[model samples]
Target: MRTAYSVETVRTAERELMDRLPDGVLMQRAAAGLAAACADLLRRRGRVYGARVVLLVGSGDNGGDALYAGARLARRGAGVTAVLLAAGRAHEGGLAALSGAGGRVVEHPSDTSAPFDVLAAADLVVDGITGIGGRGGLRPDAVPLARAVHESDAVVVAVDLPSGVEADSGEVVGEALRADVTLTFGTYKPAHLIDPAREYAGAVGLVDIGLGAVLPPVAELEALQHADVARLLPVPTGESDKYRRGVVGVVAGSARYPGAAVLAVAGALHGGAGAVRYVGPAGDAVIARFPETLVHAGPPAKAGRVQAWVVGPGLGEEPGVRDALASDVPVLVDADGLRGLNAKVVRARKAPTLLTPHAGEAAALLEVPREEVESARLTAVRELAARYGATVLLKGSTTLVADPDTALPVRVNPTGTPWLATAGSGDVLSGLTGSLLAAGLGARDAGSVGAYLHGLAARSAARGAPVSAEDVGAALRVAWRDVSEEA
Candidate 1:
C-alpha cells in the first residue's frame, strides 16, 4: 500500500532531513532522480539519442530542480532549453549549471502562444512552476502556460508535484498542471493519491530523500495492492461450515426500484459471505436474479439472524429502514439511508456502523453544500467520522475510508476507475463490503478489500468498453481468481 501524508507532515520531515543532510545534498539527489526519470521517458519513446526538452522555469526551488536536471540531460546529447518565467529571480546555481553545460536561457514568453509552440515542438515539457507552497488557483501568468502544457501532444513531467494543486488536500482549484508523470521528492502527498489531483498526476514517481521516518502517522488515504487485499481476505478453514463463515442480512430496494436489490444480491452472492439473507419489498426480483439468496418479505425482524446487516440501497425513505438502523448489529448505511440520518441514532447503536455516502449525500448529512464536500473530500470524510461516530466511506474517483475516535490511517482505494460510475455500482460495493464484514473482517479490512475487488471487477467487466452493473458482478469471479492466482 502507498500512503500520503499531509503537507505539514511532509514539511516536518523535510525540515528534519535538511538538519541532518549536508547543504544542497537533498536537492542534488532530487535533481538526479528527476533527470533519470526524464531519461527513462525519452528512452521509452525511442528518441533518447536526440529528444528535444523544454523546461518551464519558475522562481522557486521547483524551477531549480528542473534547471539542474536540464544540465544533466544536455550533457547526454539531448537538446534542452529553459524559459525563465521569473527572469531575474531564477535560481542562480541552477542557471549557472545549465549555462555551463551548454544550455541557453531564453526570455519568458510575452505572447501566449509562444510557450505552446515550444511545448508542441518538444518531446517532453518539464513543469517547474509552483510547488507545495502554492495556495488557491494557478497564478495569472501560469494559467495559459498550464493550459497549453495540458493540451499539447508532448508529455509533461512535474517536479515535486503538479503545481497549483493542493498538495495536502486533493482539491483542484482553478487551473492546474496536468503531468504525464510526476517525479516527487521525499514521499507521496495527499494530492498524489486522491482525486481530482490524482487525475492530474497520471503516474507518480517517488524519490526517497530519507524523510520517511520523521513524518507523523498522518491521516491519509491509501491504495492496497493485490497481496495486501489477499492478506485481509477471509477464507474458510477446515472446521468452518456455512454458518461458521457467517451470514449477512441485506435490507434494500423498494417497490419502485427493484434492480438495486437485484444488483446488491448479485454482489452479495459472489461476495465472501456464506449466505445472504434479504429483507425488503423487492424479494421477488432479488430471488429471480439470485435464487441462492435467502429472501424474506415484511421486516428485518422476520429475517433470520445475521452477523452483519446492509441497509439503505434503494430504500426510498421507508419506515422499515429506520427499524433496521435501530438494530444492534454491524450495519452499513448507504443511498437513501444517509439522508436525514441522526447522529444520536448512530451513537446509540450497540453494533459497529459503517456509513458510505457519495459527495451529494455526504454534503446533505453534514449540512454543507455538495461543492464543499467535493472540494475537501479528505476533511469531509474525517468530519463525517467525528460527527457520526462511525466509520465513514466517501466514494468518488478516490474512495476514502476513515474510522472515528482514533487518529489511525485512512484507506484510499487505488483500484477504482472513472468507468465504475455506472448505475448501481455503489449498491454492489456496499453488498460486497457487508459480506466481508459478516465474514469476520474488521471494518477497515472489509472496506479496503471491497474497494480493491470492486475496482478490479470493474476493469475486468469493462474489458475496454462500457459495462453494466450485472457485468461487474459477473466479473467478480474473474477478479477473485486473478487475486487468488497472484497469491
Candidate 2:
C-alpha cells in the first residue's frame, strides 16, 4: 500500500529526526538527494557540463535545497543561476555555498528580456518558489518568472511539491507549478497521491532522509497496490460450492433502460460471485445477455437467498428500492437510487451500506454545487460519509472511499483512466463492489478493490480505443487473472 501523510505529521517527524541528528545533517542529506536527481535529469539530455540550470529560489528550506543542489551542479561546470523570489530572506548557508561554488545569483528578476531569455534557453528549471508551507498562488513579483518557466521548453523538476498546492488537501487553490517530475523529500504528502494537486505533480521521486522511523503509523490517505488487491480478492477452494462461494443479488434496470440490468449483471458475473440473482423489471433483457443469471420479476427481498445486494442502477425511483435497503444483507446504492436518499434510513441498517456517487450526485447529497464537489473531492467525500454515517465512495477523475467513522484513513483509487467517464460505468462498479461485499470483504476493501479491478479492466479493454461499458465489464476476467498471476 502507498501511504500519504499530512503536513503536521511530516513536520512532527522532521523535527523529531532533526533533534537527534547533528546540525545541517538532515538538510545536507536532502540536498545531496536533490542534487543527484538534477544530475540524472541533466545526464538524460547530455551531461551536467555546460547545461543552463535555473533555480527559482524562495525564502524557505525548499529554496535552500535548490540552492545547495545548484552549487553542486556549478562545481561540475554547469552554469547555475538562482532567481531569488525573496532576495532579503534567502537561505544564508545555501546562498554562501552557491557563491563559493562560483554560481551566479539574479535577485528580484525583472520582466525584461534578459531574465526571460535566461529562463527560456535553460536546459532545466528547478521550482523552489514555494513548498508545502505555501498557502495560495505565487507572489506578484514571481508570476512573470513562473510564466516564463511554463512558456519555456525546459524540463521542470519541482522541489518537494509544486508551488501553490495544498499539500494536505490535494487542492490547488490558485496558480501552481506543473512539473515533469517532482523530487519530494522525507515522506509522501497527501497531494502526491490525491488528484487536482496530484495532476500537477507528475512523476514523483521520493528522497528518503530517514524520516520513516519517526513518521506515525496512521496515514492521512492510503492507496492499495497490486499485491494488496490480490490478497483481498476472493478465491475458490475444493470445498466451496456456489452457495458457499457467495451469491450477489442485483436490483437494477427498469422498463425504460433494460441495458442497465445487463451491464450490471455482467460486472457481477466476473467479480468472483458464484451466481448472480437479478431482480427487476428488466429480467428479460438480462436473461438475453446472460442466461446464467437467475432472473426474478419480484422485489429484492423475494429474490431468494443472496449474500449481498446491489440496488438502484436505472431503477428510476422504483418502489422495490425500499425492499432492498431494508434487507439484512449488505446493500450498495447507485444512480437513480441515490435520488431522494434518506440518511436516517441508511444509518438504521444493521448491514453495511455503501453509497456510490459521482460529482453531481455527491453535490446533490451535500447540497453544494457540482464544481464545489469536484474542486474539493476529499472534503466532499469525507463530509458525506460523516453526514450519512455510511461508507461513501465518491467517483470521479480520482475515486475515493471514505470510512464511515472518519477514524481510518480514506482509500484513494490509483488505477483509473479518463476513458472511464462513460455512461453505465458506475452501474458496473456498483455491481462489482456488491459482489466483493458478498464474498466477505469489508466496505472499504470491497469498494477499493472493485475500483482497482474496474480501472485495470477498462484500461485493458480500451487500450486507447473508445470502449463501451460492456467492454469494461467483459475485461474484468482478464484483470482478475492478471492480478492473481502477477501476485
Candidate 3:
C-alpha cells in the first residue's frame, strides 16, 4: 500500500534527518534526484543536444534545487536560464554552480515578460516555486510567471511540488502552476494523492531522501492496488457451509422503479453473500433475476434474517423508508436514503452504519455548497464521518471513505471509468458493501472493498465506451474470478 503524509509530519521527518546528516547532505541528495529526472526527460525525447530549459526559481530550498539542477542541465549542452523571484535571498551555492556551469540568471523578471517569452520557446519548464513552508498564496511576482509557464507548449516538470498548491489539503490558492509531471522529495504528500490538486500533478515521481523512519499515517486517502483488494476479499473454505458464508438483507426499491431492485440484488449476490433477503415491493422482479433470494413484504421487522442490511436505493423519501433504516444491523444508506436522513438516525443505530453520498448529497448533509465539497474532498469526507458518527463514502472522480472513531486513513479508489457514472451505479455499490458487511467485515473494510469491486466491475464491463448498469452487474462475475485467480 502507498501511504501519504501531511505537510507537518513530512517537515518533522525532514528536520530529524537534517539533524543527523551533514550540513548540505540532504539538499544535495534532493538536487541529485532532481538532476537525474531532468536528464531522463531530455534523453527520452532524444533532444538535449541544444534544447533550451527554463527554471522558475523561488526564495526557498525548492528554488535552490531547481537552480542546481539547471547547472547539471547546462553542463550537458542544454541552454539553461533561471528566473529568480528573490534576487538577494536566492541560494548562494546554487547561483554559483549555475553561473559556473554557463547557466544565465535573469533578475527582476517583472521588468518585462521577455523571460516568459524565452520560457515559451524552451523544451521543458521546471517550477521551483514556494515549497512546503508556504503559508498563504503565491507572492505577487510569481503569478504571471506561473501563468506564462502554464501557457507554454513545453512539458512542465515541477521540482519538489507544483507551486501554489497546499501540500496537506491539496487546495489551490491564488494562482497554481500545473505540471505535466512532478518530482517530489522524501515521500508522497496528501495533495499528490487526493483530488483537485492531484489533477494538477499530472504524473508523480517520488525521490527518497530517507524520511520514512519518522513518517506517520498522515495520508488522507490511498488507491488500493489489485493484490491488496484481493487479500481483503472473502475466500471460502471447504469446511464452510452456506450459513457460515453470511447472509445479507437488502431493503430497497419500489413498484415505481423495479430495475433498482434487480440491480441491487445483482450487486449483493456477487459480493460474496451466502443468502440474500429481499425486503421491498419489487420482490417479483428480484425473484425473476435471482430465484435464490428470500423475498419479504413490508418492513425489515418482517424480513426473515439479515447479518447486514442495505437500505435506500429506490425507496423514496416516504415514512416507510426511514422506518426500515431504524434497524441496528450493519446498513449501507445510499441514493434517496441519503436525502432526508439526519446524523441522529445514524448515531442511534446499534450496528455500524455506512453512508454513501455523491458530491451534491454530501453538500446537503454538511450544509455546504457543492463546490466546497468538490474543492477539498479530504476535509469534507472526514467532517461527514465525525458529524454522523459513522463511516462516510463520498463518490466522485476520486472515491473517499472515512471512519469517525479513528483517523485510520481514508481510501482513494483507483479503479472505475467514466462509463461507471451511468445510472444505477450507486445502487450496485450499496449492495456490494452491504454484502461485505454481512460477511463479517468492519465498517471501514466493507466500504473499501465495495468501492474496489465496483470500480473493477465498471472497468471490466466497459472496455472503453459507455456501459449500462446491467452490463456492470454482469461483469462482476469476471471481476471476482480475476481478483481470486491472483490469490
Candidate 4:
C-alpha cells in the first residue's frame, strides 16, 4: 500500500530529520534526487548533455532545491538557466552555488516577454514557484510565467508539488500549474492522491530522504496495491460450502428499471459470494438474466437467509430500504437508497453500514452544492463518514473509502479508467462490496477491496475504448485473477 501524510505531519518529520543532519545536508540530498529525475527524463527524450533546462525559481526552499539541482545539471554539460521570480529574495547559498557552477540567471521581467522566449526554447522546465505550503494559487506576478510555461512544449517537472494547490485538503482554490510529473520528497502529500489537485499532478514520483524512520505509521491517506487487495479478497477453503462461503441479499431495481437488478446480480455472482438472494420488483428480469439467483418479490426480511444486504440501486420509492437497514447483517446503501438517510438510525444499528455516493448524491446528503463536494473530495468523504457514522465510498475518477473512525487513514483506490462513468456502474459496485461484507470483511476493507477490483475490471474491459457497465461486470473475473496472481 502507498501512504500519504498531512502537511503538518510531514513538516514535523522533516524538522526532526534535519536536526540530526549537518546544515545544508538535507537540501543537497533533495537536490541530488531532483537532478537525477530530471536527467532520466531528459535522457529518455534525447541526450541530457546538450538539453536546454529552465528552472522557475521562487523565494523559498523550493526554489533553492531547483537552483542547486540546476547546478548539478550545469556541471554535466547541460545549459541551465534559473528564471528567478524575485531575484533579491532568492536563496543566497543556492544562488551562489549556481553562479559558481557557470549556470545563468534570468530575472522574471515585468513585461514577461523575455521569459516566454526562454520557456518556448527550453527542453525541460523545473517548477519551483511554490512548495507544499503554498495555497490560494500563484501570486499575480507569477501567473503570467506559469501560463507561459504551460504554453511551452517543454516537459514540466514540479518540485514537492505543483504551485497553487492546497497540500492537505487536495483543493485547488485558484489557477494552479499543471506538471508532466511531480517529484515529491520524504513522504506523499494528500494533494498527490486525491482528486482536483491530483489531476494537476500528472504522474507522481516519491523521493526517499530517510524521513520514513521518524514519520508515524498511520497516514492521512492510503492507496491499496494489488497485494493488499489480494489479501483482503475472500477465498473459499476445502470445508467451504454454499452457505459456509456467504450469501448476499440484493434489494434493488423497480418496474421501471429492471436492468439495474440484473446488473447488480451480475456483480454479486462475480463476487466471491456462495449465492445471491435477490428481493425486488424486478425478480423476473433478474431471474431471466441470472437463473442462479434466488429471487423473491416482497420485503428483504422474507428473502431467505443472507449474511449481508445491498440496497438502493435504481430502487425508486422502494419500501425495502428501511427493511434492509433493519436487518442484523451488514448493509450497503447506494443510489436511491442514499436518499433521506437517517444518521441516528444508522448509528444505532448493531452491524456495520456502508454508504456509497457519487459527487451529486454526496452533495445532497451533506446539504451542499455538488461543486463543493467535487472540489474538495477528501473533505467531503471524511465529513460524510463522520456525520453518518458509517463507512463511505465516494466514487469518482479517484475513488475514496473513508471509515467512521477519524483516526484511521482513508483508503484511496489507485486503479480506474475514465470509461467507468458508464451507466449502472455504481449498482455493480454496490453488489460487489456487499458480497465482500457478507464474506466477513470489515466495512472499510470491503469497500476498498471492492473498489480496487471494480476499477481494474473497468480498465481491462475498456482497454482505451468505450465500454458498457455490463462489460465491466463481465471483466471482474479477469481482475480477480490478476490480483490473485500478484499475491
Give the winner by TM-score: 4
Q: Mind sharing the TM-score for model 1?
A: 0.95
lDDT of the candidates, in the order given: 0.85, 0.90, 0.84, 0.92
Q: Determine which window of 10 residues in candidate 4 has minimal summed lDDT.
A: 109-118
> Over the stretch 377-418, how does candidate 1's per-residue lDDT look in tens digits?
988999999899899888997899888865688888888567
- Write candidate 4's Cα lDDT for 1-487 as tens digits: 8999998999999899999999988789889999999999999999889899999999989999999999999999889999999889999899999999889988886555667788989999999998988989989888888898899889999999999999998899988999999999988999999888999988999998898999999999999998899898999999999899899999999988889999999989988989999999999999888999999987888879999999999999977989999999999999999999999999889899999999999999999999999999999999999999999999998999999999999999999999999999988998899898988899999999999999999999999999898999999999999999988
Residue range 205-320, candidate 3, lDDT tens digits = 99988888767655555667778878888877998776688888888888787788788988998888788888888899999989999998867877766788888888764334
- Provide the RMSD of all predictions against the true structure, rounded to 1 decimal: 2.0, 1.2, 2.0, 1.0
* 2 against 3, candidate with superior TM-score: 2
Per-model TM against the reference: 0.95, 0.98, 0.95, 0.99
Evaluate model 3: give its lDDT. 0.84
Regions more than 4 Å wrong, model 1:
109-117, 217-219
Q: Where does the lowest 10-residue lDDT sum fall in candidate 3? A: 316-325
The alpha-carbon lDDT assigned to residue 411 of candidate 3 equals 79
| Residue 243 lDDT, candidate 4, scale 0-100 | 95
Off by over 4 Å in 2: 109-113
Evaluated at residue 335, the lDDT of candidate 4 is 93
Model 2 weakest lDDT span, ten residues long: 108-117
Better of 2 and 4 by TM-score: 4
Model 2 has an lDDT value of 0.90
Point to the candidate with the largest lDDT. 4
